[model samples]
Target chain A: MYLCISVLVVFFQMELLTLPALRRMAICGGTHGNEMTGVYLVQEMARRQKEEGDKAWPVPLVLVLSNPRAMQECRRYIETDLNRCFTSAILSFPITDSTPYEIRRAHELNALLGPKDSKEAVDVLCDLHNTTANMGVTLIAYSPNEWICLHIYKYLKGKMTLAPVRLFMVNIPKNEAYSLESVGKNGFSLEVGPQPHGVLRADIYNYMKEAIELSVEWIGLFNSGVMIEGGEVDAYVFHKSIDYPRDPESKQITAAVHPQLQDQDFCCLKSGDPVFLSFSGETVCYKEEEALYPFFINECAYYEKGIAFHLARKTTLKIPSVRVQRN
Target chain B: MYLCISVLVVFFQMELLTLPALRRMAICGGTHGNEMTGVYLVQEMARRQKEEGDKAWPVPLVLVLSNPRAMQECRRYIETDLNRCFTSAILSFPITDSTPYEIRRAHELNALLGPKDSKEAVDVLCDLHNTTANMGVTLIAYSPNEWICLHIYKYLKGKMTLAPVRLFMVNIPKNEAYSLESVGKNGFSLEVGPQPHGVLRADIYNYMKEAIELSVEWIGLFNSGVMIEGGEVDAYVFHKSIDYPRDPESKQITAAVHPQLQDQDFCCLKSGDPVFLSFSGETVCYKEEEALYPFFINECAYYEKGIAFHLARKTTLKIPSVRVQRN
Candidate 1:
C-alpha cells in the first residue's frame, strides 16, 4: 500500500511543495534524569504499548532513556547536565578523566538515535522536559520556520485544547546549540512546568503522556499519508536569556525574581516594571523601552547557571502546506 | 532583664496550677532530608536571624539542623527515615555493626535534645516537615488530650488564616513514637505539603517560615506570661492509614487515588464515595458509613511504605483556661 500525498514537510526550509514523509521518530526521555515528566511518561507509554500488543506507531519510535543512573539517583544529572552535552564539538572531545556521566550518555544516545545528520537518521524527534519555571506546555522549536515543525505545533495545539501550547524559537549563538533535539533532524522540545525536577505532579504527568502519545500518533498518521492542515501558531520567539542579579563580591545570585512577576511567564513586560528584588531590599526593574514577554522564571535547575528567566517577543508563525507519503 | 513569669505549661498532665514556664523550645527541621520546606525555611530563618543579630527569644531556642548531610544529598534520608529513627528503643540499641548513618545521628541528637525523660530537656519542641501530600499546614500532636497541644492548634489556626491548619493526633502502641518532637516535654510536628521532596516552592517556603517563626514567638510569649485567649480549633484527627488498591496476585498497588479525592484532603467523605481507581477500570469506593474526613492523599514518599492516604475524624478542640503568672 504505497500512496503519494502532497503536504508541506519541513526540510529545514519553508516551502509549500516539500513532501518528505516521516520515516522514523524517536521520543527521548530522561534526558536529564530528574526531569521525571519525560521519564515516567516514556515508561508508561512503553508499558501501555507492550500491554496492548504492538499497536506500534506505523513509523517505528526509538525510545531513548538517556540517563538511567541519574534517574535512579533522582538528581538532575549524575555528572554534567545531559541536556547540555549533545553537541558535535563536545561529542568529538575524547572521553577523558574530566568527562562527566551525561557526556558519555550523550555519546551513547547519539549512536543509538543519531547520527541525526546522516540520511538514515530518524525523520523527526520530540524531547520531553519539565521545569520549575511556570512554562505551561511550552514547545521549543529548533527548526522554527520549517513546515513539519509548524504542523507539529498545530496538531499539538488542536489535541491539547485545554492545555495551550506556547512556542519558543531556539536561537543560540553560532556553533553553540546544546539540546537533545539539536541532535535530531527535525524536532522540538516539549516542556511542561512549574513542576519541580525530581517529582512528578500526576496532573502534569498525565498531560505529558498525552502529549507524547499524540506525537507518536501524529507521526503514524504522517506515515499513513494523512492530510495534515497547515495552521498558524502564536509563538513567543526567543530574544535573550536573562540571568539573576549576582553580587559583585561573591558572584552568587543575590536577588529573587519579584513576586508579582514570578510566574507571570510569557506575559508582556512593560518598561519600569519590577523584576528582581535583592536581599538588601533593592529592586531591579525592566528598563527596556519595548514591551517584552518573559518565561522560565526561577527555574530551579537554572539556579547554578544563574538564569533567572528568558526574555521573548510575541510573534505569529504560519504554516501553509500539508502532505505525506505512504507505501 | 530578668523577669518573673509563671505559665501553666502542661507537664504531660493538665494540672491547672502546674506553673512551669517554657524555659526552652527546640525548633527542628529536615527531620526528613528531602522535605525541603523545613530545610529551606530553617536555612532562611537561620540566615535572617544571624543577619539581624540576636533578637533574643524570651523562651530561648535550640535550632537543630536535624540531618545536614542527608539534606546535602537531597534524599528522604541517608539510610532510614530520620522521623522514624528517634524512638528510645532504637536509640538505646547502641552503636553496633548494623548502625546506619541516621541511627548514629539519632544517638547524637538524643544526647543533645534528650534524655527524653529528663528535666533539663527542652520544655517545648516544634519540628517542621513537608510532605508530597496535599496537606496544608498540618499539626501532628503526640498528646492530643493535653492542654498545650490544643492551645498550639488554636494559635496556629488563628495565625495561618489564609491557609488553615489540620491536626493529626499521633496514636501508636505503647513505647513507639516516630518523631523528634516526641522527645520534648510538650510539642507538635508541623507539616506543609503537596511540595515534592528535594525541591522548594517559594509560596510553601514562605508559609512554612512564617509558621516556624510564629511558633517561636508563641513560645517566647508563653515564657513572657502573655495571657492568650482561650479559643477552639477544628482539627481533623487521624484515624487510619489507607493503602491504594493492590493487585491480589502481584501484591503491587495498581490504583491511584481517584481524581475527586486526590487533593481533597480533610474534606468529608461519605460511604461509597470514589476513593481509588484501578488500572483495570475498576473504581474503589469509600465503603464506610459514618461520615469521615480524608487527608494526606497520595503522599509520594509514602509510596514505598504503601500508604495512599489517611482517614481522619473532625472534632473541635477547646483551649479554655489561658492564664500565666508574671511579676
Candidate 2:
C-alpha cells in the first residue's frame, strides 16, 4: 500500500512539476580539430553511456563531435576555422557552389544546436577546447553581458577544490558571434592547456575530465530546486590583440618576445615593459602605459594568425543568486 | 748570459715536445636555423669576443653561423636540411645548373670547415643544436667508431653536474655521414632541448652556453698534454624509427602514444608494454619480446615528419684513456 501511494504521487507530480526543470543539455567537442583533449573526453563519455545505459544524466543530453574530417588530418581546420564560422555572414551564404568545408560543417551544426538568435534555444551548451598557450583551465564567457554563463562560472568556482578558477569575458561586438556557445542559450567554453597539438598530456586531460563532471552535476542540482550560491567573481574583460613586431618594408615578423616575458601569461605589464627584441639588438616596449593583464602568450596556433598575445583588464562583478517560485 | 741560456733551453724543449695535439678549432651554429639558442649564444659569444679581444681561448678558434639566411626567416632551413647536405655525392655535384641553397652553402662551408675527407680538416669542431624533443643536454657522436668523439664525450660528462648526459649514435651505415660534426676531426654535437623552435627559453639557453664553454675548455686542455680520465660511458645506440600507427588502406594515423608512455623517453620498454592506443579502444604493445629504450618521443617538429618515436639500445663502453706525451 506504501509503494502504491509513492508511484501514484510521482505520476501526479510529473505533469505539475514545471518551474524548476532542465529540458535539454548539449556538450560539444572537437570544434577545432587540433584540440584532442575535448575530442578524447567526448569519445570516452560516449563509451561510458553505451555501457551504463539510459539513466545517466537527469535531463536529455546530446553529444556533438564537430569537424570529423579536420580532426582526421590532425591540423586546426581544413578550409576555415570551424570555431569562427557560426556568424550569419558566413552561414547565410549559399551552401551550393564552392562552399568551403567548414562552412558546410557549420551549417550542419547550426541545424542541430543553433539559430543562435532564437530565444528558445537549448537550456545550456558547454564547449571544450585546448590551447598551445600556457593559460590553465580557463572558463570563457563570450561577452560580459551573458548572465547564465556568469552563473555557471560562479557555481563551478565554488565547487572546484583543485587548482584555480579563471573566467574570460571575450567581448566581441554584439552583432558578430563566432563560437559554438553563440548557438546556445546559456553556458560557456572551458579551455585547458599548454598541450601541443596531437600530443596527449595526462595532467591537463585529468583536470578537464573533472571540470566536465562538475558542470553536469551543477545542472542536475539546479533542476532539483537546489539554490546555488553566487557572489563577486574576479574576471578579466577582453582588451585588444597584440601582434609581434614586424619590419616596415618587408612585412615579415622580425623579433621574438623578450626572454624575460616568454611564459609570463595573465601577469600585469606596465608601460615600457620590454616586449620584443629585434635582430639588430633593439628593445620594443608595451607602449600602452596602463597596467594590463596579458594572456595567450606565444601561442603556436596564433603564429599563423599573426597574433603574438592578447591583453585584458581585471574586473569584478556579481552573479545574482537564482530562485524559482513554487507554483 | 743566464736569461739567454734559459731561452735557448725553452726553444729546444718546444721542439722536443712531439705529441699529437689539436691545432685549429671551429664551433658552428644555426645549421638548423630554428634552433635559436645556438644562434643567440653564438652571437653573444661573438659580441663578447669583439669587446674582450682574442685572449679568451688558448687556440685559434673560429665561429661559423652556418645558415644566416634561414636564421633571418626564423625557420629550420631554406632549401634543404643544411646538416644533410655535406655528403660527397651532393657536395661534388656541379654548382652551375640548379644547386639548392643549402648545397651551395655547404660548398662554402666546406671551403671553410671541411674538405672533410682530407687529413687537414679542423682538429676539432663543435656543432650546437636544439630540439623540441625532451632530450636534455645530449652529446651526439655520429657513430660509435669515433674514438676522439668518445674521449670528448667523457670529458664533457665529467664536467656537467646538473643533467644526465645522452649520446646518440645516429646509425647510418659505415659511409654517408650527415652531420656538421662529420666534417671536422674530433668533436660532437651538443644538443639541448624540449624547447620549441623560434622560441628562446632562458633556462635552455643558459645550459647550452655552459656546455659550449666546457667544450672549448676541453679542447684547450687537451692541446697542452693533459692526461684525461676515461671510464664506462652509458650510450644509446640507434636501432630504427617508429612511425605513428596508421590505417593501411586509409593512409591516416590511427592512434596516439599510450598515456603512461607519453614522456617516457630514454626509458626502457619491455615486451607487453602498452605503447600506442587506438581511438577504437585497442592497445598496441611493444611486441619485440625484448627491452629497448625510446628516444625523441612525441617531438612536435617530428610530427609533420611522420616519426612517432625512435628506438635505441643501451650499452656501456669504456672510452680509452687519452694521454698526450710531454717533453
Identify the leading candidate in terms of DockQ. 2
To one decimal, what is the Cα RMSD in angstroms of model 1 from the true structure? 6.7
What is the TM-score of each predicted model, taking all chains together?
Answer: 0.85, 0.71
What's the TM-score of chain A alone for every prediction? 0.89, 0.88
Residue-level lDDT tens digits of model 1 in B138-228:
8888655656667767777778754767788766632478678877877688889767665555566666766766777766666666666
The residue-by-residue lDDT of candidate 2 on B28-77, one tens digit each, is 88988878778877776776677777786777778889999998866678
Fnat values, one per model, are 0.04, 0.19
Instruction: Rate residue B301 of model 1 by lDDT.
Output: 75
Best prediction by TM-score: 1
**Which 10-residue window of candidate 1 chain A scores lowest in summed lDDT?**
A1-10
Distance from true position, residue A89, model 1, in Å? 2.6
Please give, for residues A1-327, the per-residue lDDT of candidate 1 as tens digits.
Answer: 123222334421354444677877888888878787788667655766677655655666777777899887767788778888877788677888777878888887877777746676677878989887777888887645656767777788888854667888876631366788877778788899867666555566666766776777777777666566665678887788888777698674556677678778988999999997654456799999999999988776775676788888898877765667434
